[model samples]
Target: MDLQQMRYVVAVAETASFTRAAEACHVVQSALSHQVARLEKELGARLFERTSRRVRLTTAGEAFLPAARQALEAAERARAEVAAATGEIRGRLTVGSIPTVAAVDLPSVIRTYRRRYPQVRFSLRAGSSERLVEQVRDGALDAAFLGVQPGFLPQGVRDREIGQGRHVAVMAPDHPLAARHEVDLRLMAGEVFVDFADGSAARAQSDQAFAALGLRREVAFEVSGVELMLRMVRQALGIALLPGAFGAELHGLRCVPITDGPVRVERLVWSRFPPTPAAAAFLALLDV
Candidate 1:
């Protein structure tokens, strides 16, 4: 019923642990748990299923978190609007990005934004593109920088294409294809490959390229984190196809361009609705 109670629920839902949520909200664990329990009693539904291992949202919590988040965001927007009307732009900007976005110079962007609006605070969250997109849609994140393919964007979200690059192959120096500047897809068909998880945009593009060539990939490992895949490739477990700008120029490995595949575009994505003042300001600088 209260904003604090709603915030408590959201924090628990996000962190999946009462102790961690209490830490995030800067409250004592006992008080946070008491408030959430009171709210559940008022609503007459179990919000979370708690186990010794983790907390999971029940059906009711899943149905309620989005609207609660929107209410919180709307309250923030109202406060920001009043402050902005006084010619002072100050508020929190929640931003999400993928690990591969290290190539996008986000740190420089944040530094520049801070110089312009020192009153604004930023909280940066890192995750996969899929998780970022989900957060943006639910208003848990104000905006995000994502790696996506053209025309596959999530609904109710807008994106600006900032820059783009393509996938490349990396292998040990002693690998047969190391001497070559580029490697053909067919040449590596027989080799065990390290690749992204099937749900990732990078994996989708790689899959399409293989399907087009009528070749089936021999996936030895499918990992969610590209860093782990790079490590696997470096250790000679298997070759990997990764973004050309992944910033992993292994001295012991040769990086080569994939002869065919769709280009990976880096986009600045946000909800289509009005955003927080800090997020708006940061987004404005994205085009500059």
Candidate 2:
């Protein structure tokens, strides 16, 4: 019924332990449990099933969780909007991005935002473009930077294309194709490739490209991090196809232009609903 009770319930659901939840909320376990118990009594339904070992949400708790989160977010947004009216922004801004984001210097942008709005807090997460977009849609992230194959757009979110570029083949300096000015997909068909994990948006870009050409390259190394992929390429374990700008600063590796490579489009996506004041201010900072 009250915000504090909702907060306690959410914390308990997240931590799955009343003791941990109390610690997170900076309250004593007995007080937090009393508040939750009062809330459950008011609703006439048990919210959690507690045992000596662990705590788990009941069916009613699961049904109430989403609305509880939305209510909390709405209250926070209202407070932030009132603060914004007084020429101040005070709220948490959660942003997500792909590892290879290059359209804007994220650290620099965050630094500027912090200087302009010191009262605002920030959280950053990195993942594949598809996952980032999904997080944005789910309200876990206020905004996200994503990279998808050309001619495709993420659904259920508002997006803006920031930049686009072609994929380049990265290889060890001593590799035979390293000296080539540009390499065709067909020429790389026989080479072992180091690619992003399967089903990831980064990997899909190259996969769709190769499939379109009716070619298949052996992906001997599948990695989630760019540094790992680069390391594998540096050791001549395999070559990789990555965004052109992503390989520009690497050392001891050759980035060959892929003449018929997949095109990657970088986009900034946000929730379709009205954004919180902090999120709006950050988007305005980017002139979006």
Candidate 3:
């Protein structure tokens, strides 16, 4: 039976008088009697015994009372939970990002989000751009900040250009490149380069820059992560052309300006999903 019908049955059973039950339910006694009668007919069991002086429960009425109350309670609870999840905006939000953006930017944003919306929980995953995009497309993640490849992104996903960064030269502190305020394409024509691995957006830009200059330098090493690439550079294995912010932070590595033809901009990309209150608040805190 419907919730309204169940409520009427519960109220009538509690009061043991149709007049009192109608008063409690804000309805007339005759209307309440009509509804309870309909319920009894539908169930093929009489729920009440009405005498000239009093009303009492039947054997079936006692058994059905608790179940009806429980069903109404459960329905109300389900409605509340749905409202809390969709209407109030509180739940676990799974976010993914590329390794570089995760390391450099998301920590502060996450901290602000947690501080503002303590009720919500977060799950962070880090991977390459391809992997993060795939997770977002598959609905495994709510959103991600991933580097975009040169080709097409997946369908149904949206992109926002947050900010841009560029590649710079990373060399040892004692290297000759450190002596110059800025280095040019001609000087780096023959230096050993520690390259980023395949399938990386940074690597593609680096390759394009080197190709336009007609430079085919030696590859001293190939590494996947920015940290590892810096570590290799710190050992003086070879100099690397890395993201500008990455080179700027190294302790012993001298980051020189690349006075080349053009600097490749590192775009901070985000998902098209409307930001949750948590995500929106976090993005607002970042405005300062």
- At residue 125, what lDDT does model 1 achieve? 94
> Which candidate, 2 or 3, has the higher lDDT?
2
Residues 158-261, model 1: lDDT tens digits: 87777777777888777788788877788888989888888687677777778888999798899988778878888888988767887354567788887774
Worst 10 residues of 3 by lDDT: 261-270
Best by TM-score: 2
Query: Clashing residue pairs, candidate 1?
Result: none
lDDT of 3 at 237: 80
Find the number of clashing residue pairs for candidate 3: 1
Could you give candidate 2's per-residue lDDT for residues 109-161 as a string of tens digits? Answer: 99999999899989999998888888998889999999888877899999999
Off by over 4 Å in 2: none
**Model 3: colliding residue pairs:** 165-266
lDDT of each: 0.83, 0.92, 0.70
Better of 1 and 3 by TM-score: 1
Off by over 4 Å in 1: 5-68, 150-153, 247-251
Tens-digit lDDT string for candidate 3 (103-171): 246787788677766766778987766667777666556677665434435456765555456567888
TM-score of each: 0.80, 0.94, 0.61
- TM-score, candidate 1, is 0.80
